[model samples]
Structure formats: C-alpha cells, structure tokens
Target: MTEQPSAAAHAKTQADFAANLASVRERIARAELEAGRTPGSVRLLPVTKTVPSDRLRLAIAAGVEWLGENKVQEALQKSEELADLPHLKYSVIGHLQTNKAKYVARFAHEFQALDNLRQAQALQRRLEAEERTLDVFVQVNTSGEESKFGLDPDDTVAFVKQLPAFDRLQVKGLMTLAIFSTDQIAVRRCFQKLSALRDSVREINPDIKELSMGMSGDFELAIAEGATVVRVGQGIFGARALPDSHYWPGFAH
Candidate 1:
C-alpha cells in the first residue's frame, strides 16, 4: 500500500491552499479596480477539472464559493461527495454535449458555454422534462478562431432571436474564449469583440447581463474588457494531472 500523508502534512497542504486563495483574490480585486469595476462585481469560478474532490473542499473551506467543472460525470461525483457544502455553487463551463444536458440540468446553477441553438433546445427539453428552469449564456467566438466552439459574431444576433422558443431556459449573457497569443493587444481585441457582441445583444434584449471571459492566463485583459465572470484554474490550483489518453476534459493546461 502507498504511504498516507500525516496530519501535519494535511495541515500544511490546507495552509498553502488558503494562502494561494488569498493571493488570487487580491489579483482579482486589483484587476477589477483597474477595469473601473468593483471587486464584488466579478464572480470567480475556480475550475477544478482534474483535481481531487478533497482539495476542492479545501478550496471551499478557504472561501471559494464558485466551482466549475467540465464533465458532467465528474461534476456529478463531486457534488455527491461535497453535498453538505451549501455555500458553494457549481457551474458547467465547457462544451456541453446535447446528450449530457440532463446531467448538467440536474446539478449546475449556470451553464456558461451554450454554443448552438440545438444545445439550447436539448437543455430546454431536459429542463422541461424535469420541470426546471436553467440559466444559460451564449458562447461567442470572440477570437474568430475556427478551432473554438462558439457561434460566429455575425450569427449571434440571429441565434439570440430564436432563443425565446426555449421556455425552460433563460439567456443570461455571453461567454467567449480568447486566442492564445503573446500579444496583449490581440488578447484585448478578442475581449473587445465579446464586449461589443454583448452591447448589441443587450440593446435588443436588456436581460442579457453578463460577460464570462478570461481564464488564468488572459483574465486581467478580460476583466479590463468587462468580464463579470472569470474562470481561473491552474493559477489557483497548481498544475493538474493529465487524464488518460481516451479523454481530455475542457481545461487550460
């Protein structure tokens, strides 16, 4: 059998995790201030993709109220294990498969990356079947990168026009992934596009109120561009262990 960590080791791990949470919170506050927004205006969803449930609970105890997971199965398991933590809210912030809508509808409070109308329809069906309402955000391809999975900027208006048919789902705002590049201007441009898209969407439908952008790497620029929700993973929790070759859950490396 493998050696188990001692009580002292466990305590130290929790302490380190607490310290890291403090540092990340400070950075988030500073980013908000620089962007002319209050720190309370931003919601930090710590993506705990491949991390252990125990460590996730440690982060929660350290005052992490929002947690994000990519896969429905993994999140389901986490929720089962962390069921007693009432203060923490879980979110689905990845490319959601239509078939998996049932799982997300049951567990998540917010579904961040709803890309196409079909996915929205799927979620609507599931929510109706269960007699529930879901809060969802439209994913925008801000970078104009073909590899990303969101609606093209030109197509979003038409798509949003069709969303009212889904009675069980509510459109909260827009979410986007920036192009990974060293140039800050390029990153900022991606965020600006998302902001512009939000502006147009809100002009037509004032209920679309959020912009979920930024990750661990480009979150500062994203916040500067008015991101109300920022997903930070590796920066808060250290590097994650890679999953077996068969599946790669959506997360930053």
Candidate 2:
C-alpha cells in the first residue's frame, strides 16, 4: 500500500498547488496579452488525470473549480470521492467509448473529446433518459496524427451539421490535441490549424466557438493561435509518473 504523507507534507502539497495555479494563470494572462487577446479569453482547464482524489481535493480547495479527467472510470471515481465538494465540476477530456456514455451522462458537466455520431447518439440517449444535458466539443485531429482520437478536419463541418439531431448533447465548440514536440513552430501549426478550422465552422454555426487545444508544454502557442480552452495537466499538477507516451503513443518527451 502507498504510505500517506504526514501533516506537514500535506500542507506543503496544498501550498505547492496554490503556487503552481498562480504561476499558470500568470503565464496565461501574459500569453493572451502578448497575442493581443483579452487576458481572460482563454480558460485554463486543470487536467486531473492520474491525480489521486486527496491531491485533487487540495487542488479544488486551491481554487480549481473544474477538473478534467481523461478516463470515464477515473473521473467517476473522483466524482464519487469528492462528492462533498459540490462546487467542483468534471469534464471528460479523453476519447470516450460508446459503452461508457452512461457514466458521463450521469455526472459529467462537459465532454471535450467528442468525435463521432455513434458516440454522440449513445450519449444523447443516455442524457435524454437521465434528463441531463452536456456541453460538448467536437474533437478534431488537427495534427493529422492517426494515434489521436478526433474527427478529420475536413469531415468536421459535415459532422457538426448532424449534431443538432442529438438534442441532449449541446455542441459548444471544437477540441484538439496538438502534435507533441519540442519544435515550437511545428506545435503552433497544429493549434493554428484547429483555429482556422474553427473559424471556417463558425461561418455556419456561430455557437461553435470554443477551441480546446494545448496542454502544459505548448499552451502559450495555443493561446496565441486562438485556443479558448487549454487543458493543462503537468503545469498545475506537477509531473505525471508516466510519460506522455502512456497517453499519446509515440509522443516525444
């Protein structure tokens, strides 16, 4: 079993969380201003994937209102564990299986990685049954990476056109995971691609405005490229024990 930290250690952990959250917000503000966008235009979604509930609670206490989890089971577990913290909301940011739509329908406030009609239909049925509505972002594979789970950019327009049939699932915007790389130019290209796609889609559906892109490493570039939501994990939660390859196969560290 894992040994629990002492009281001092727990206190230090909370302190670190607050400090990290502040630093990230500061960087976001700077990035937005540098890009000539309003400072608060982009939202920082702290990803709690792989983070334990105890630490997650500390993060919530440290002013994190919404937590993004990459797995349905994990997010459900955390929601149950942190049920008392009613102010906290959850967003499932991973590729969701159709079979797991019920779990998200029952609890998740938003689903950020929506890609296909099958998954949307599954979620719509469950959400309708449960009398719950969920905010959804159409995931676009802007990097054109096969490993990523998102609809092709070319297919997004047609896909969004079909979403209105699923009344329970509200199509709010688009989401993407940029190619993980050290080369800033290459990374920015992915964000730019998504932004451009969003712009094109907006011509038909004005409500589809949010662009969920970027993560701990390249969020600044994402912000400059018009990301409205950046799913930052490592920057706020410290580092994950597993490498990025564990989540994104062939992801360069």
Candidate 2: misplaced stretches above 4 Å? 1-12, 242-253
| TM-score of every candidate relative to the true structure | 0.89, 0.90
State, as a TM-score between 0 and 1, how close model 1 is to the true structure: 0.89
User: Residue 237's C-alpha lDDT in candidate 2?
Assistant: 78
Instruction: For residue 58, give model 1's deviation from the true position in Å.
Output: 1.0
As for model 2, its CA RMSD to the true structure in angstroms is 6.7
Q: Can you write out model 2's per-residue Cα lDDT over 106-202, one digit (the tens) per residue? A: 9999999999989999999999999999999999998888888899989988988888898998888899988877777888888888888888888
lDDT of each: 0.80, 0.83
Candidate 1 local distance difference test against the native: 0.80
Mark the regions of model 1 whose C-alpha exceeds 4 Å error after superposition.
Answer: 1-12, 244-253
Among residues 3 or more apart in sequence or in different chains, the pairs in candidate 2 whose N, CA or C atoms overlap within 3 Å are none
Q: Candidate 1, clashing residue pairs?
A: none
